[model samples]
Target: MRYPEQYLQFIEKFNEGEYYECHDLLEEIWMEDKSDKFLQGLLQLAVGLYHRECGNIKGARWMFGNARKYLARYAPSRWGLDIDQIILYIQSCEQALPDADSIPYAKAKAMAFPSLRLLIDQS
Candidate 1:
């Protein structure tokens, strides 16, 4: 499937604290490409962020970790994200690996969506 611009827009919304909007935006891409690990990872992170806004920490952690695992093998940085910064951020997040029930996007997108967020989170 062609990379959709809406996906980019979702990330923009996410960075702006529009968690719900991001989820809604990514859901479109996700529904169309349910089997795509990259999109799944990206969408899941958005949903996780939505959950984070709602205080669902456990769900956020699960989705963020899942997103990272998928993207780690895929090198999502080519699509976005700063490889060097990610390596460093991920290392730090890993070292601290909060044991909370959730991984919050307002504070954890770098280690959550990681590269996908990097593309959208880039100011």
Candidate 2:
């Protein structure tokens, strides 16, 4: 399936660790169709990463949890992306952080962030 330009931009921003920009790019498309689970999943993933970057552990956890729920149906691939791999990365992020009201900024900053790659079509 052909991907939207904004979605392509989202992927670029996402891989570059510009999570906020990723959100901005994807939210435009997502707003047009709230029922689009795939878009919701990608948007949530971006927001989750943004929250993590900002040291909002609770928010990050919340977004990550919801992202997984939305994206789960799309696994293990969709629109040239590895949905399963993305989900696994989210799982790892959730696992790495402690279940607490808040975590230190340094802790959050020290955590390794995840990046995604689109699967190139050879056909």
lDDT of each: 0.59, 0.83
**What clash pairs does model 1 have?**
57-101, 57-102, 58-101, 58-102, 61-103
What is the Å distance of residue 44 in model 2 from its true position?
0.6
- Which residue runs does candidate 2 get wrong by more than 4 Å? 113-115, 118-123
In model 1, state the lDDT of residue 21: 80
TM-score each candidate: 0.63, 0.88
Error of 2 at 89 (Å): 1.1
lDDT of 2 at 112: 72
In the range 1-123, model 1's lDDT, one tens digit per residue, is 334798778757866767678767877777886877766666665665566555566776676677666656656353555544544544443344456766555565454433224553343
Best by TM-score: 2
